[model samples]
Target: MESATLTRPPAGSPAPSGPTARLHVERWPLIGLVLLCAATVFGFFYYPTYPNYDSLYSMLWGRELLHGQPLSFEAYRAPTQHPLAIVFGAVLSLLGQDGDRVLIAITFVSFIVLVAGLYRLASRAFTPAVGLIAAGLLCTRFDFPFLAARGYIDIPFLAMVVWAAALEQEQRRRGTPVFALLALAALMRPEAWLIIGLYFLWCAYPASWSQRITYAAWTAAGPVIWALTDLAVTGDPMFSLTHTSGLAEELGRAKGLSAVPSSTIDFLVRLDKAPVAIIGILGFALAAYLVPRRIWMPTALFLIGLGTFVMVGVAGLSVIQRYLLVPSLMVMVFAAVALGGFTMLEAGRLRTVWAAVAILTVLGGVYYTTTRVNLHVFENELRFRGDSRNALEDLLDNPKVRAGISCGPVSVPNHKQIADVRWLLDLPKSQVIARTDETQVERARRGGVAIYAANRAVLMRTVLIDGMKDPIMTQPLPGFRFVAASDGYGAYVRC
Candidate 1:
């Protein structure tokens, strides 16, 4: 097959107008259908059973809204609990079907949106052909399928960032819709806050003082609104922010900020299949040396995201590989641009070599997805969730336990770490009242709460070892009987 490239009009010619002209001039993402078909086929055979932990946390928020319960901000504010994803999960529940399938469907849709977003951004920055190739190459990377097979917010959040970039590139203006997409992304994850902040700074250079101020204000709005909402309910304006900060401080104090450099290097080695990571590195190199100056905006944005991820690690949060998606995306775009050739390789011999390489890279991705990662992700998720569900159900089925149990007190780290509270309590939100101090546990015994459940591990730690204190302040309280235990959880009912 011949290699494809965009056709630009001759110099001094007037820009073409109309939809027909646009179609002929721009490259469409023909590779998107391939991605769709692959995802659809994989989902049919290996739909995920276990929701990722953050995803389950978000679903609890959705469940809360569904039941018209108020969200408790003073409780551990799940960093993963974005309003949009919670809403998305709530909407998914309305189907009243098997939750596993609904979650699978969410992953499938997130894949499509991600591919489409990448294509749009590539098309705007380089060429439609480049965009198509970039999206195709992304589909082939080993980690992509494993991720696409689960309903992780990482992919959805990246999709929003890429799509916003596409719109900004195409419009050449800070339009309202673009800002809206960005705001949605920021609300979904704090990582996007880095991207949003960089954008505001970028605006300061070329934009008028008034325009910069307007964009800056818009950029600040999402976080401000989220903070205010937390304040309204929790009576503390900084509840969510402080929760995240406190976690970081604990982690930083224990692990030290030195962990950041190792985490960033680990990202380079493991974010994708080795070959794709190599290609991404090569793409970054080529973008700097060969691609047009116009591509610098995305390069800068990628660096900003990377720096932000490192700073997060410095704060003591574990930097997982998926956290690198924003930078990975820019690398893919750069790789696509590199593969397409800056000025389009001459026809015949060079074009033939280019086409061959593109086909092979894509085929490598297909083999990895079908033969390895898909089955791995599917089976592991099913096994993990099966055990988790068994533990949760064992607790829920005990006859003596009348109402849902408090997960325990708000201040304890283990309270947030307890496994499957969402499934155990059968409640809408993850926050059950906490019985942290002796007073709360006593209150629960005195008609305050009917039962309290904890992950077997969390229960052992809180009750036996730590006595629910930061430094083991007191002995375990009496009057609670163990009702049941399972592979992954334990329950106690007030006697």
Candidate 2:
């Protein structure tokens, strides 16, 4: 692609000077491939680099697929989550692979593929040189890589988001390639729609107003097409969306906006421990700076796509920046430009300074990655893992307590675990509890429960779990046996 500037590069046009430029451009891909590979290997080899909560659930759903179970719109509660993820999970299970390993691998590969897609898309801009710079910076972004290597939908959604942008102008013949991939992704995670919408903008930008409306209709056709197929198979065209939207706000109003700043600090400060994120951000910034002027239309379109997305923060994600991952990844493209050394900067002194900044950003990213150990590998070292999985199993140790409820092969005790304990225990309840959490004990005290239990660790966990404890009543149950185990969680057994 030729530069759109009045002056060519050598005349202080901010373009590369000297014979090495083209050669460097040609070699951009190699660097992208190497950096991506390095980040991926590091992420997977370490302690899965994924939290054991939602990350683990996606893996479990995938295991279900491997077991020949049909994807029930109701079975895996997050109706909007991509079904493709579960399909991927099932395949891993069939191959007898560990769900975590497979999910992490898929995440890593998808990220690399997203970078390649960006490289292809960027080819229309800077020489391979600038594209490689973009790839490298993106490779080290503060948040993208960390989430990119998990079984979660954000990374894959991000890849598709870029892909849509690349095809912005290409006709359907070259656009929408076997949207089964998109459908599956959309099914597993509803947020993939953000990518779809962004890609649609890139695709429809060049059309006439009438044609733009047509393009809008056409872009939505992918989901419509899937809905029709779903209807044909399941007799409910909108079952997934209908089923999912209902559950979106199930958690209700969460703790609120305080989580945003805390998460931002986590994302940025984390750069010290995982430099790959910074590398990615800087490389993307460089690409933004170097993208050919003609390519600005598409890049601008990418930004619009991203902006609209975050504004639509879903019911479950309103309070946290982590939920902003979808939009964050999208904007990172422009951010790369920002890091690439400011597109608005004129050639000469400021440009030189911007270049210095970009170089420093990239250098800082590298230093962060090299020095940051994958400390999560030793996450198990800490107690109160924040994981609810197997928590019920571990806590209900008494034979009589375990015997009261029957689950698995034998009947789990008749007692059903209450709200907030769903993930760590069986759901849909074998038997209803009088209440859950705070209300639970109150009801148990009023009526008659053989045993009253509460996690004492809830009070002591002031340092670890956020919102760990709500409150224990000032009044005590007459015969309650309060047991505060050293595990940082307490158990109360009522006689």
Candidate 3:
């Protein structure tokens, strides 16, 4: 496709007019967005939480780097490290115990950036009204906020990619700024490698040789740095790919190519929900019919996102919902267009009827959300994440538990708590063992401090409910005397 400038209404369509149009066209759009993001941050400030499992490992590895220690990427069930995340982790690790919460704060900022990027892209491609609707839809999707709150690297990765796309939409062949953002995104997720590569080709033909070389260098940085990092630490350039695949298989998360079709549909429905999914399809069709050029980028993004998801499954990596985030986001944009793109039409009966349809669709969505959405479930989950982490910290900080750690390794019920315990205590891998490992069962039995769930909720979520089928793993080791207890966790030492 030829590079095109920012989208304008098709041919002779009249420019937006009247009060509604004036409201959308003014400076208030950006001001309103700023206020919304500010409110969101302030509202959630009190509920500061730690990183998710993968992100915690990033901080741990970063701490190792900061202290001149080799990264333990080869540790059992270790997540693949992203270059930029590790760098941020190394910087944040300087904060010591407060690093985790700071990382989460950065994630919240990234989420805001993502929402703004979505608005900019959609608005530039269509109108400010569509942009506002897109932003609203994204905020309403609880999963996006939930991911941001949990400090998932995916949030930042999405932010970079969305902003890159928005910049490109603002001015086609945007060059370095666009490539720079995607390069940063590529450091966070390998999926961006594909995006940046395709973008390089798209812009290459119109560029001089030097520009192509620069873009190529930008394209190679993410994977090359990742490989070198892996090779330096694990002595295998392919360690991340192989290790992640093996881990996925072990965890029963890798679904093969045969399941891609079903998984794609299922994940999209889950992300966008059924009502928005149906509306997105209609909107996508309407946009395609009305102005194909306007939606080319979104259309390409939707396809590329799906293509990468398929590539992931084919490569034996874990096939999860987050992989489809790009496409789901496009669905939100297109759905916004269906609901508000009519505003771009010249005043007429057709515009009036379409506007009425949009209003009813929104009302129906509101009704569906009101009846089906339960705020308490989201509240409970967020509450548990904060509560559980605090409880684990309290248990680990207890003097008795600290004294017991000197006896031998610290053992948890399974791999779920490995990073948490290790990070909390700043202990080496050998110093922490998961009782679920058959080899470690005897070691755990021999001597060490073992942590356990303090209550039914914690037990069901942590110890008893793991991928391991071994019932014996959850049983208390013989001779372990209770040492310390906290609201969500308990500790015992066999020494």
- Least accurate 10 contiguous residues by lDDT in model 2: 407-416
Q: What is the lDDT of candidate 2?
A: 0.47
Q: In model 1, where do residues sit more than 4 Å from their true spots?
A: 1-31, 34-38, 41-50, 62-70, 74-104, 142-150, 204-214, 248-256, 313-318, 338-343, 353-378, 386-419, 427-494
With candidate 1 superimposed using the best TM-score fit, by how many Å does residue 478's alpha carbon deviate from the native? 11
Give the better candidate number (1 or 2) by lDDT: 1
Ranking by lDDT: 3, 1, 2
* Candidate 1 lDDT score relative to the true structure: 0.60
User: Candidate 3, overall lDDT?
Assistant: 0.86
RMSD of 1: 6.5
Error of 1 at 327 (Å): 0.3
**lDDT by residue for model 2 over 1-495, one digit each (tens)?**
233431223211234557797566556577658866886787566534433335554444555445544443343233343445545655655544344556667777888888876665443343343445456555655356656543556677667656654554223324345243444445545555555555456556665687567546655655665576467536888775555444444434233234445555454334322343454455454544444453453445445443433343333244444444533443444445555434434577766787787778667756755676454543442223333223543554545444433422111111122322332333332222422233345444542222223354433332122223222322234554544322323344443
Ranking by TM-score: 3, 1, 2
Better of 1 and 3 by TM-score: 3
What is model 2's C-alpha RMSD? 8.2
Candidate 3 positional error at 155, Å: 0.6
* Candidate 1 C-alpha lDDT tens digits along 104-132: 66676777788888877776666567777
